[model samples]
Target: MVDADQTFVIVGGGLAGAKAAETLRAEGFTGRVILICDERDHPYERPALSKGYLLGKEERDSLFVHEPAWYARHDIELHLGQTVAAIDRAARTVRFGEDGTVVRYDKLLLATGAEPRRLDVPGTDLAGVHHLRRLTHAERLRGVLAALGRDNGHLVVAGAGWIGLEVAAAAREYGAEVTVVEPAPTPLHGVLGPELGELFTELHREHGVRLHFGVRLTEIVGQDGAVLAARTDDGEEHPAHSVLVAIGAAPRTALAEAAGLELADPAHGGGIAVDERLRTSDPDIHAAGDVASFPHALFGTRLRVEHWANALNGGPAAARAMLGRDVVHDRVPYFFTDQYDLGMEYSGWAPPGSYDEVVIRGDAGRREFIAFWVRQGRVLAGMNVNVWDVTDTVQRLIRSRAQVDTEALADPHVPLDSLVP
Candidate 1:
């Protein structure tokens, strides 16, 4: 039933967009495929921007999702360095670039992704103040970190989120002085809650990273168009040669908004509203990755996930749904972080009010343990720190939604799989 003359257009050239195009071809869709990207570089994953690539452990060529010739070889039209200005739902066309070239599509996929939130204080435009969301930003920050290391320069990181902590670790590895400022009581306060958050605070302290909690960055003071210090609400000035604003990110839904597409409520981490099949209000248009907010059946809530794994799996799920195949994106929310000698993987959603108690297995003092957030005896989420090959067990515990005894869950000798039945 393939429509050979139909055209499928994908906007954004990140992991989700590229993967969706590849999925279409792999599924034997002989239709016209077009992909548009605002960045000049080929599609790439974003994890390396804060991990190996930033630390100089990964080569530049490893970032791209495909080689430059891959698209042409597969007969996929790729338009790089082009931004879509408008989306015409009625005409099924998208206008982009200075010349306003319009492309028609029978089916459309929006993988626009998200943009990093900017610091709203004075001197943010000054040199040495950085934000890491794109490859260009990471490339510049990598060199800045090396120079800072050689000069023993001080780096003031605003917000102790994943990006901030990862960059801080990379900076420490490069021998640069790092100071992280967070308004919360601990690092990763929103994600891990205070209980496990304290563990991260101790980890960074052991690695010589200065942490200032219960304080927000008020202003960035600069001299000669370069950052000099970061002023905090706690009435302290931290001397800084460079500043990093790793606050958070907002989904890029401007095009969807202008086109009058239904969007999720802002309180629910707003993005383009989609069903379980990733289809928008207009059936011809679908969305995936960070920009798509869909109802999660297991969590019984609408969630917009911005992690790398979501993009890795959501793209193909959306592609199959586009091809008239039944698809439901119900993967458990997952993410990971590496700081210093510790590596951790988190599965399931356990926001502050959702989980009543947290259970820990193994020893926290040794930084080798698994933590589970439980609500009324049902496991809601789990995190394994410095634990190996247990992701499957952790995710199974979450998906099973089985009531587990607190003592047994906390016992390291107890097999996790045995608790499910």
Candidate 2:
């Protein structure tokens, strides 16, 4: 049972934190709802940082989850640009910054998000070296793209993950010659597998983005305190006017660790360990978004997803759980990306090499297709690229767990729904 008078304090005013507050208000928890965020701006979508925002296709005003007035209307006490310095779990209070401002709370929600993983190579701290994780980074990079005047500037991108690739695409769109470096045999090999990774490789190649796999960066060469080039172990030197490091991210778990909350094993990527209900080891505490590692019903394994949809969906689910509502916060893992003319939507998670076969409908060469991963004739995961209005059918195919006929699924003529039902 939830006490209406108990104060609810939410840390990290990102998507998850904002959504959790929205859920609390919607669920009739009228007590004081305090939202704390280190960023100066309101909670906004992150995907735009690499796509529309970076490319100048969208305005910053449209990125916010809600305008400043909305939080005031909901009576949510919004604290921005304030870092939580300490959490006194025993006293049920949190300390803010150097001022030692303490706030008492009956219940706490940890939505602390992830931050960009820094490159360990030498000269990484030099000027012209950048990483994109927050709105500020994107805004800075937008100016860098403007500086790189089209067709004359060279930008070197480190890593080939979704963020790296999207930033590369945006840079190239701005007329910079972009080069992507990946140490793996193929980009995104760990997540999407080499087959699809190579498809993306082709997409980048067609867009005039040079890709180098199976190579590691030795050092970032700088001239006069500014990055000028990067050298690789493979004896290749990339002359870059600007360098963007997109090498993954690490979960912001310092708060959870300091408070002695149980965390996922280091081998499991290290996040706050939570049950399906999003409750931490302490029932009075809850977690959501990238920081929380919960059991995945569809994946049948403990999974931590760092996607927009995960934060959007998991926040509300955790809020309900915090309110003592009986809820199983399990949903299919879903993510999407846009690169050049290719728009990709992927639903479900099957461990790499676990899927028995991949059935394709439509043409991969033409940049339009739906790829389905099957295990023992049952659909495990599906990806629809440049094919709109089919995610519902694909998600149903995965949740239903009904065996599918590969022949009909691969046939473009057969409707996806027909095979599932």
Candidate 3:
């Protein structure tokens, strides 16, 4: 049982922490909910940082998870721009800042998310080189992209992940020449497979975004601390005034590691390890979102998902688990992305080689389709691309895991619900 008079400290002010606080209150915990964030802004959606927000289609204030008044109204304390220096699990307290202003908690939640992986190459510190993870990074890159547009400049993008591709689309929309350098044979080959990646390849090529597949980036050449071009290992150089690195992100597990939390095996993409309930080794401490790698009950392996939906869903589950409820974070992993005019929503877990076949519905040539990964006739994963009002159906198909007829699954005339059984 938790003491009603005690405080509940939540580290990291991202969506997971904010949602956990909301869950604690909604579930009638009524204890002190203190959320600590290193960033100055209130909790906001990070996806917009590379997409709608970067393109200026969404306002800065609109990105916040809740308004300033909402936190006060909910009786949640927001410690903006405050760094949590250390955690004393034995003492049930967290120390912050150089002064080490210690805050003791009856229960603690670690929602510290992932950070962008940086490049080790020379000229990475150049003025025009950028990485997008936070709002400030997007703000700076937005300005740089706009400047490039006005000057009819070029921006070199290293890596072809979602962020890189989305930003490439935004930069193209801003009328700047864009080139994406990828070490993989196909962009997003690991996740989308070669077929879907080839479709994306066509999409970018159609939009005049130059893509260099199977190319290794050697370095970013700069003039007077400003980017001039990106040199490839193959000795090819793409001229540019700005460079954006979007390789990938590494989970921010320093605090968890320092505090002696059990970490996942490094071979499994090292992260703070937690059970299905999102409870860390310490009974009073919980972890959620990107930093916590919990065993995916469906996939039979631990996964740390760096997606908004995971954070949003995992938070409430962790909150419930913290409140002495038997909770399993068993929700299907879902993530959505908007690049150019194409919007995509994917659900379920499909480990590499787990699926025997991909059954795609609709016209792939037209860029409107739903792709499903089937293993032993059961739907393992599904993705709806440029499809309307079908994500719920896709999720249902995945969760139900009913042996679906590949023909019916691929039939446009057949409603998705009809194939559910």
Per-prediction TM-score to the true structure, in the order listed: 0.98, 0.98, 0.97
Candidate 2, after superposition: displacement of residue 327 in Å?
Answer: 1.5
Per-candidate local distance difference test: 0.93, 0.89, 0.89
Please identify model 1 stretches exceeding 4 Å from their true place. Answer: none
Per-residue lDDT of model 1, residues 267-336, tens digit only: 8899999999999999999999999999998999999999999999999999999999989999999999
Supply every candidate's count of residue pairs whose N, Cα or C atoms clash at under 3 angstroms. Answer: 0, 0, 0
- Residue 113 deviation, candidate 3, in Å? 0.2
Candidate 2 has which clashing residue pairs, if any? Answer: none
Q: In candidate 2, residue 5 scores what lDDT?
A: 75
RMSD values for the candidates in order, in angstroms, are 1.0, 1.2, 1.2
Question: If ranked by lDDT, best first, what sequence of candidates would result?
Answer: 1, 2, 3
Q: How would you encode candidate 2's per-residue C-alpha lDDT over 1-421 as one tens digit per residue?
A: 5666789999999999999999999999988899999999999989899999999999999899989999999999999999899888889998998588999998899999999898888989888899998899999999998778564888999999999899888888888888999998787777788778889999999999999999877789988997789888899999898899988888899998999999997666679999999999988889999999998777777888889999999989988888888988788889999989889999988657879888889999897999988899999889999999999899999999898889999999988889877
Angstrom error of the Cα, residue 393, model 3: value is 1.7
List model 3 lDDT by residue over 202-238, tens digit each.
8888899999999977899988887889999888999
lDDT at position 52, candidate 1: 93
Task: Name the lDDT value of residue 406 in candidate 2.
Answer: 91
Worst 10 residues of 2 by lDDT: 145-154
The local distance difference test score of model 3 is 0.89
